[model samples]
Structure formats: C-alpha cells, structure tokens
Target: MKEKDGISECPEQQVILYVEKEDGKYEAMQTGSYISANYLDDYFLKRGTLEKALGEKIARGEINAIEYYMILEDLTISELAARAGIMKWTVRRHLKPGNFSNISESALKKYSIVFNITVKEIVTRQSGNRN
Candidate 1:
C-alpha cells in the first residue's frame, strides 16, 4: 500500500516527521520522525499556563507588554532583544510595567515582526489571548 507524504507507516501510529535528504527524489525519500505527543502536550500546556500568569502580571503592574510578546514568541530576553535590534538592557528595562508607557512605536514594530503579530495586538491583546 502506498502512503501519503505526511502520513505515518500505519494508521495505528502517529508521528512528527521531517524529510530526510536521501539520494532519491520525492516519493522515494524517507522521513525522520518521532512520537512525542506527551511532550508536545506538556509544552503547550506550560505555554498556556505561563501566558495566563503573564497576563495577570501585566494587569497587576509587575511585568509589561514585553513579557507578553516574549512569551508568545517563545523567545528569551536576549533573543527578543536581538530580534528587536536593541540592547538586552533595553529589553530588560521594558519588561517592567513602569517603563512600558515610554516604549517607542518603532520598538513595538520590531517586536511585532518578531512575534509575527501586529502592533495593535502587541499593545492590546484581548482576553484569552488568541492571535
């Protein structure tokens, strides 16, 4: 029986796959795959939980909009700063709620590109935080 490009070897099995660069063309190429639903589920759950916490922090005058952007992008402070083309210290400073009002539109634009979201979304994420 023939299998589809993204399908597993059997219906009973599921996997996350990547194309392996073998010597053959499309149909003959093999996939490097793994089964890790538990891992993926746990990771997504942690992200959701963390986002909820971050939202509360934003509401409570602890962290700022930067924390939301960073969580959504799954980026570290250094990575976010790098993507924004700014200093890490700048990013750190922006993480505080007190400094958010002073953030420039240009800087928000940079973060918008990194997070693949619009500046409006960054500034005012709605409840449930769905993008």
Candidate 2:
C-alpha cells in the first residue's frame, strides 16, 4: 500500500512494513498491527497456551528441537525440509528424539539457520527456552 494509504490496526502495537521508494528500493517502515487490539490479544493468549503445552511436551522429551521449532514457526514438514535443504522423510525422522541422534553436524547447522538458533542451543536448550 502507499505510505498514506497504510492501515491503522492497533494503536499500541507496532509492526514493520516494507514500502517501495520512488527509486524502486523497498524500505522498512513502522506501522501498526494487522489486526485490532482485541484480536491480537486473543491470538497472543492462544499462542501462549500452545507454547506452554509444547514446552511441557519438550521438557518431557516427547518432542525434540526440530519439531518444536517447526511447530512454533508454523511450518509444514515439506516447508521445513525445503528451507533446511533436507528431504521430507529426513526432516520427519529428525523430528523425533531417537532419530535425531543420526543427524550430522552439517544438518544441525542447517537447522540452526532455519530456526535462527545455535547448534548448541538446539541440543541443550530446555522448555521455555528463549533468548
């Protein structure tokens, strides 16, 4: 949208939007949330519940880092595989703790890139872990 035509969502929430300059380069612009405050609050509440439940599962070792990050990022197995440059089946395998042991260092690095985390963090991070 044009700068003047930008939407006003939540006055309290700030978001980043890219606007095209006259020179054709996109620039970062600060904008409001896409949704209203009440909707954003509801979304945050639901996401918080999901995070808490997922964190508990992770703490119980029911799911590993790959699955945790993938779920939090809202990525499908196919999307994750493509982002990490792995096969769909391989991504699925690594989602479990047992099969994660078979993954290589290079693959770990790729996951780190995809998750925007460190390899050490992936292996050692606990539930509710955030930087």
> Please, what is the TM-score per model?
0.63, 0.66
- Give per-residue CA lDDT, model 1, range 49-96, as digits (tens): 988887877777767777876876779999989888989999888887
Q: Which ten residues in a row have the lowest lDDT in candidate 2?
A: 122-131
Best by lDDT: 2
How far off is residue 129 in model 1, in Å?
9.5
lDDT for each residue of candidate 2 in 11-78, tens digit (9 for 90 to 100): 68888888776677878778787776448778889899987777777777787767878898999999
lDDT of the candidates, in the order given: 0.69, 0.79
